[model samples]
Target: MTDDSGADLAWETLYGETAYMCPGFDIQREQVRLPDGTETDFDYLSESASVVVLPFTADGEVVVIEEWRQAVKRVNRGLPAGGVEGEDVDLEATAVRELEEETGYTTDSVEHLTTVEPANGISDAVFHYFVARDCEPAGEQSLDFNESIRVETTTLDALREGIRDGDVRDGRTAMGVLYYDAFA
Candidate 1:
């Protein structure tokens, strides 16, 4: 048997740039060399590192948020998530800030659960998953402009059921719940 695959392709990027600018992210363009030594242009999104926080109470309830997603034109239930603003902070800091800002849940005990890239084919964004145990209501939610969020708490079983029944529609939230259920 013989294996013929694109794996033998010697691909290289000639140059790249941020093509379009947005508030938080931008589109990137690059020229690439194919296996046949031919060149083509590649376009992708360049985003900063992001975080998803699975905040859990001492009694094992999970804190979640529901907010309007303009792209989908519906509200979504998801973990408190956001992108790291700058190089001055780390992933854990991003997790803590997002959790508090979106849900008003704060935790002194936070740990990295996992990192996922939802669309590596078109974006360079990494979603850092975090498990925040021993959380409590720290203060009122401080949302950004144009953000309206609702914070809710539910048991792990109920959360799983919501996902199974398609009530929870956010992919990162579903993954975060699964990770919390299995490991944290």
Candidate 2:
């Protein structure tokens, strides 16, 4: 007996771009040959990157940020998160910067938690998670031009409840907390 089953089709990305701002979206053009030997063109949206931080105090309280999301038009409770900036900025650095900028807390130790990809359908963004331990109140928050955030501290149980009740709807935050509960 002989088996001749393999992927012989090809998918070629013709063009792609970031199409919209605000809630940024990307568009892509592609050409592909189907398994049935039919050729076709397709379009897709590219993904972006995000970061999440699980900030903890010496007493074990978790630090979270409450911010108004312009796109969602609602206040969301979650960990400090932001997009990656320059090539020199690593994911851990992004987490630290965002945590400080959003919550006004600084930590000398940051440990990698886990990464999550919320939407693979349209975006290729990764949510980098970090555990910021031994956090200290540094100063007032320094938000970006579009950000309005408030910092809050909660017990792990309260955090879990918020997540279970959908009060903490941010996917990355939920994942980070869950990861902490499981491993950290």
Best by TM-score: 1
In model 2, state the lDDT of residue 15: 48
Cα lDDT tens digits for candidate 2, 7-125: 44444454444444444446655565566766776666654577788999999999988888887889998888877765636777787887888889999889888777777665567
| Candidate 1 local lDDT, 1-184, one digit each (tens) | 5448756665799998888998878999999998788999999999888899888999988898889999899998888898788673677877888899898889998899999888888989898999899999989998999788999998888888989999998998888888777876
Q: Can you list the residue pairs that collide in candidate 1? A: none
What local lDDT score does residue 59 receive in model 2, on the 0 to 100 scale? 92
Provide the TM-score for each candidate, comma-separated.
0.90, 0.83
